[model samples]
Target: MKRSSRKQLQNRRAIWMSIIVLTGMVWSLYKLSASLTLASASLPLTELAVSPGKNHAAPQNGTSRYKILIDPGHGGKDPGAAGASGKQEKAYTLALSKKVFDQLRQDPVFEVVMTRTDDTFVELEGRAQIANELDADAFISIHGNTYKDPDVSGTETFYYADDSFVLAQKVHEQLVKSTGFKDRGVKKEGWKVLRDSKHPAVFLEVGYLTNRNNETDMLSEAHQIRTAQAIANGIKNYFARF
Candidate 1:
């Protein structure tokens, strides 16, 4: 073969090799750029939060706290029910109501109010009136029960208006699980406090006071705390859906 012809062929081969190497480098760079773009697009929300306490925070542009009204069933001279342990329903109701109220007050998410904070007489009509006047988001009247059989020991939750059903169901479900008591199930009743309230309202009969075992359990400090926690959790769960 001639030298010039051989030299031309060698130069052409070298140029083709360089072109192949350059093309491979360009393709690798493109793939790396694509990977970086995808990583940036899918970054975690926590990493992007500009302020402290904003991580995983829900959008609360103009949300306001919910107002809750609690009514102790009976107070003052009106003892709605009597227990085997010689405790009046009024006393137990007031105590439990306060506990539940305190539990809910821990979070700034709720504005808590009680019909009767102490052993003071407040009529059924008056209770509903307070809730209406305050424009409460929800109302719950707490009570204890009594029966001749004394064997009937369980929790009872009642709702008067159609809007009250969801609150009753949620609170009752959580109470039943927390207390590990017989679930009497959610019921419907036209109690004055419930029926008259403009906002959603529910009545909770904690347990049959006539039952010695239930009466003792309800009076326990531990059970009261659990009961209060359960009610708070239920209320929170109810609001979470909305």
Candidate 2:
């Protein structure tokens, strides 16, 4: 073969070899990039993401669980109203509030907290403060009513905020039905707890302790459980709006 032809042939071989080397490097880089991308996608998002803080976990549907604050009215030194049978309002409120809390706690949709679990004095303003600090979705205060006329017997609910009126109505409706008492209906009042709470708040005067019939029913365990169930149902119904 001619020397020039031989050199040209060698040049062609070198060019092809260089192209193959470049192609191989390009393919290897692409494979590395693709592997990195797949590994990144496989990593759990929660592991990479920062937490939003100490709030309740959301449901599978991406909705947050409702945070409910239950306040039992008039505790410790504050005995509230007196029953005909001498039952203190504190005792009645605590009992009923606990029942409500228990029912609510059973539902995974709700995260329930109580201002006072025992007969401890929690100031009216303090109760609201707790709810506000916790960023509770709702606040429910349980109480027994009293009047100059012992015959004034019924279930009444109070709310201070305009937004809370619906909550009051929902709870009061169930309360009246459960207690089988005359429905005094929902009323607006600037009670300390209702007024101070940042969230929707409802104050339940479950029954007039001054009335013999109301007192008897309010003090009964079965009646208390029924009332608690009603209150829990009302709260669940209200949360459904969200």
lDDT (Cα, 0-100) at 66 in candidate 2: 79
Put down candidate 1 lDDT per residue, 152-171, tens digits, no spaces.
89998999988788889999
The lowest-lDDT stretch of 10 consecutive residues in candidate 2 is: 52-61
lDDT, candidate 1, equals: 0.85
TM-score of 2: 0.74
Once fitted onto the true fold, the runs of candidate 1 whose alpha carbons sit more than 4 angstroms away are 1-63
Best by lDDT: 2
For each candidate, what is the lDDT? Answer: 0.85, 0.88
TM-score of each: 0.75, 0.74
Instruction: Report the lDDT tens digits of candidate 2 across residue range 55-153.
Output: 222232355577889999999889999888878999999999999999999998888999999989987779999999988888999999998899999
Model 1 sits at a Cα RMSD from the real structure of 6.5
What residue pairs clash in candidate 1, if any at all?
none
